[model samples]
Target: MFERGTPGADRIDALRGWVGDGGGLLMVGGYLSFTGFEGKAAYRNTALHEVLPVELLPEDDRVELPAGGRASAVGTGHPALGGVTGEWPPLLGYNRVRPRPGAEVLATLGGDPLVAVAGYGAGRSAVFTSDCSPHWAPAAFCEQWDGYARVFGGLVEWLSQ
Candidate 1:
């Protein structure tokens, strides 16, 4: 959502201030999130990077899955994944990220984090390191997976709480 110059900087500062003041924030991955397709989603160079529960890669971090990929809820039984269990529907791909120390790793894809969360001041933040739609997420994930709503809904509810 950040553009150029002062406006983008303002948005970054505002988001930090808002989250620190008890607002909820969520970051979904894509060609414009974290380190995008060609490094266009350069949040690694922004202040928003610190508020996330995962460390952003300094370069393009997209993990392509031309043959598709799947994710699994971690063993922690986090409320954000309340009823989600077993293997997840196939995903076209996801962004690669490392979980920050003390942050909760709710789900994983291969050896990388698929979902992570952290407390930011009085508020909270979460990251879903994959797309919610086409390209990265296929219909099986966005339209057919029964846990989609529950997982995302639970995240929103958790952050809002």
Candidate 2:
């Protein structure tokens, strides 16, 4: 990721190669992820874009839901859903994204891709398009929910495989 919009080709290729060689890539969402605030996070059209299971919007994709939005599990039978079962606590917000073809939509929030996973070459890549911490992931979702660990643990487990 570039601080000044410069995703150097070398870094992009290196990351692409790493993922292609079976490395697991996990992208967690936040103000600085997937075209964040004021279009600053900017992961729209890079090598990261190529491998991510979700497509990043060219503009800022933050959707604030102070009323909160709950995740709806959609990837039943997928390894990413392993032991993660039960209702999910409400998330404060998330980065809007679309699941690419062949990518499994593991979960959704506000009718958008909240968690998505895909295979790229010999590797795997997954994304949780919401903050793993604060603001978006609130205390209700992170601390008071058992499924929180189950969900993330499942994603990690699936990615590692």
Among these predictions, the greatest lDDT belongs to: 2
TM-scores for the candidates: 0.92, 0.91
| lDDT per residue as tens, model 1, 53-155 | 9999988999999898788788447787757888889888889999999899999987799999999999898999999877688888888888888889988
In candidate 1, how many Å is residue 131 off? Answer: 0.1
- How big is the RMSD of model 2? 2.7
Residue 97 lDDT in candidate 1? 90
Clashes of each: 0, 0
Off by over 4 Å in 2: 1-9
Query: What would you estimate as the lDDT of candidate 2?
Result: 0.87
Off by over 4 Å in 1: 1-9
Error of 2 at 119 (Å): 0.3
Compute the lDDT of residue 81 as modeled in candidate 2.
66
Model 1 alpha-carbon miss at residue 148, Å: 0.7
Clashing pairs in 2: none
